[model samples]
Target chain A: MPDTLSEATRSEFDRDTSVRLREPGVHDADLSPGWAIGHALNGGYLLAVLGRALGKTLPHPDPFTVTAHYLSATAAGPAVVRSETARAGRTLSTGTASLFQTGADGEEAERIRVLATYGDLGALGDDVRTSAKPPIMPPREQCFSAQDYPAGPDATPEISKRLDLRLDPATCGWAVGAPSGRGEMRGWLGLADGRDADPLSLLMAVDALPPTAFELGLSGWVPTVELTVHVRARPAPGPLRVCVTTANLAGGFLEEDVQIWDSADRLVTQSRQLARAKLD
Target chain B: MPDTLSEATRSEFDRDTSVRLREPGVHDADLSPGWAIGHALNGGYLLAVLGRALGKTLPHPDPFTVTAHYLSATAAGPAVVRSETARAGRTLSTGTASLFQTGADGEEAERIRVLATYGDLGALGDDVRTSAKPPIMPPREQCFSAQDYPAGPDATPEISKRLDLRLDPATCGWAVGAPSGRGEMRGWLGLADGRDADPLSLLMAVDALPPTAFELGLSGWVPTVELTVHVRARPAPGPLRVCVTTANLAGGFLEEDVQIWDSADRLVTQSRQLARAKLD
Candidate 1:
């Protein structure tokens, strides 16, 4: 088992092994609030997991863009799910994943839909343009430790797990440090070793922003309702800074639009997420 | 110029001989408050113009769907613009239009982006499914006219120009029978001619919802900042209704969500808009 798993990058996480392409089921411990006891799982977390799964399916040395929006919230158990590549064309390939979960009362609680497109840059003509440059920031070695931002006692085990994170004063990055029994979480993220550049490496860095920003205020309280993200472009790995400019809060919804720029001052990628807010 | 004008089928509008595929270059009369001026002329009216132009380019009997979203507010004048087809397949074609407005001071005030898709139903392989199924309503001959509703002076001009609308008792359908020359106004709308069918036809009946629902009860009125709309399915034309569900107001900004449904109990499209709120 250990020999076969080495192909997947090793996560900083110690307790929970990084999910493998062969793994078909998610642990029950990952289910968080807004999730019925009988609920299937978190949609946002599922999206991330599926992203990881689909990312593995793409050919190596490929660049792809994955975008997802919630059609309806779904819960866990009994309902079936299947992921398939509809058209894996020579230049561009498309993949879809569908998740279905049934409730305790026999009603369907959720449905998750994902569409991913993988592309080979070499095959296309050059038409490259970026709106803004990526920002430069502090290195991971210079940042503070995870203990300083401890997850509260009541914090879902899914979130309390440690993460190796570093911020470019302007951008946020992190890598999974420990197994989070909880379904999903966000916080400072970065690599312990400093190596970067791959999509997974960037995602490991980008996904940490939400938890980190919210934690700055809560210190321990509050949880997210849902998280929706889009990657507009990819940034280079280096001593870069990212700035999270605006966080719009209205009604019971919160939306954050963040942009990451590489050290070259070229705009890298833009990301936005919507989450239900809770005052702790 | 006199010979180019022709009576439209409804006898209420004049069809110009010169199709306007671009934004208006000349100044229009100053518009009143509460009126969706850009929408009336650009999004809705201008589309008719584009259809006329495209009609000249393509063969007759070309079925297409036009979707427009206001990127910024505009004033009367020549706006640099361009149109291009992003994708042109045998069965499906997508076109995008961009408009840029330069003010008297040579400052650009607004940029408008529109995307439209043209399709031939006969091409798709035996798969045509429409989700909306609104209930039937009484004929136009039996329904009461806007003469029965309260009218505001500035609302007369727009109110007078009405469309055929019908709504089931559960939903709200709005239209202005005779719009006055200025400010915001409202009146119930449904089957002006009292035609009944599934919700698909009803989809074509209603344009965007008015901004009145969000401004009601506020000390100051609100002006639109920007508006976006999407038509998921073409619903039948009758008994349609709209109910203003909720509005988020803060920091002088307002966002409203409206739900439209047909007589048959199917929830149709949901409309949303954003605007700046101010005191009347």
Candidate 2:
């Protein structure tokens, strides 16, 4: 959509272009290209918009944690974000942000409701330290490009041009008739423009992978009902390793847990979401 | 506190006593005896109160998902709950609730911000069903009561009388000088009064376990910054099994994931929280 890949990535994240401050604690955000799952805009993309607004209104510079409830599906357009500071403490601040759109009757209807906590991750200090090993992944040269997957007739071109993903063959069995028999997906994710990953990009990357339930032989549109993202740390400058796992899929509902590790092999973000499973 | 363990358990969950309706969409709740970690009340206990209020206001009878941001520590006293319906869909509803308390200046101040999703768990249907097996635990007779651990001079008696916990010896290394190389705490949890486990109790049980970081030799008040609970199903009447594990602890912070299983061997709830690591 933009002249260069870097420009496109920057445009996607540029608050001035994507989110325009209309007034104090209120803003208008543009739902641009490439951040969509089918026709509806991606949930994480919306979260990033709301998070940016919350970050500006709150005292904190980074979004430590954000939980968004998808009220209704929204298409590409201009949306309004209204944020309120629920609590402002010395170390942490909590608030609520509601993303709305104009209805046919000229009334504002909410499409996404967000609750978030913001703080300076670096300022928290490091007295205790321990970390689990990152998920083992094959070298980028050996992995298959997710971009190579045959696009459906209705597939949007912006998706492939926006996100660069290399899938781990072992967990890509869903592509063929042979399912993995396990609910998991592994891939390497980076902005197509080769931009460095940040807290906001980490939020978008958590939902970039295909639904892990697809590996369990469940198909169709799996719309998320609620999603929660925990920003563990800022990412180093490089592609991020991604892993998505599902522990349970029952009663037409499933939960997906996503883990993102920066190039430095440090865990940067973790998220879990509950979505309605569309089964054949 | 209530004369007997049964009475105490009932009192903790008695909506009429703990939650008093002040007006439409407004409620006053009490943070009472035995639910405190020290001077501040337990995060899960506060969640149960807010969840109960949200469950009453939303059309959905069950709280399928809830995420709360702890802005500041709350003490034992009366707090007000204000709830707003963000979206009222046909099958699911999203809402926000803020718990507030009177400050020294006699002004209402927010303590906790909650984002929740409510729906009819039963009505969701059972077309596609799968579940991860519950964690392996010894019989109740073989496990040791958490109460057996000698309390410090500051230990609150209400914690012991409110919850009956039988620790899994394998993960209970923190009780002694030996620390589990891995950050984890496993045990069986139930109401001391022997009430049947439900969604509300399940919410409380998720946070009832001691911080898993303790097993990693990190001690002190590991307060949660944010907590999210996903109610998978209705418990089948009995003691619930619990497992708390931490995958990463860095930058003076860690994330704990909690899993709960009902007596009938069903995974009733799963939760994840980000908390500050209080190391010695």
Candidate 1 segments exceeding 4 Å error: A1-4, A7-9, A12-46, A55-63, A70-81, A86-90, A100-111, A121-131, A136-145, A150-162, A167-188, A192-197, A201-204, A211-242, A262-267, B1-280
Cα interface RMSD of each candidate: 17.9, 2.2
What TM value does model 1 have? 0.39
Per-candidate Cα lDDT values, in order, are 0.38, 0.80
Q: Which ten residues in a row have the lowest lDDT in candidate 2 chain A?
A: A1-10
Score chain B of candidate 1 by TM-score.
Answer: 0.52
For candidate 1, write residues A209-258 as lDDT tens digits: 43433422322322333222333234455543445532223222333444
lDDT of 2 at B196: 74
Q: If you assessed candidate 1 against the hidden native complex, which CAPRI class would it receive?
A: incorrect
**Which residue pairs come into collision in candidate 2?**
B34-B158
How many collisions between residues are there in candidate 1? 80
Question: What is the per-residue lDDT of model 2 for residues B12-107, given as tens digits with 9 covering 90 to 100?
Answer: 455322566778888777778568776778788889988887777788888899999987777788888898888888988888888898989998
Indicate which candidate wins on lDDT: 2
Compute the lDDT of residue A39 as modeled in candidate 1: 31
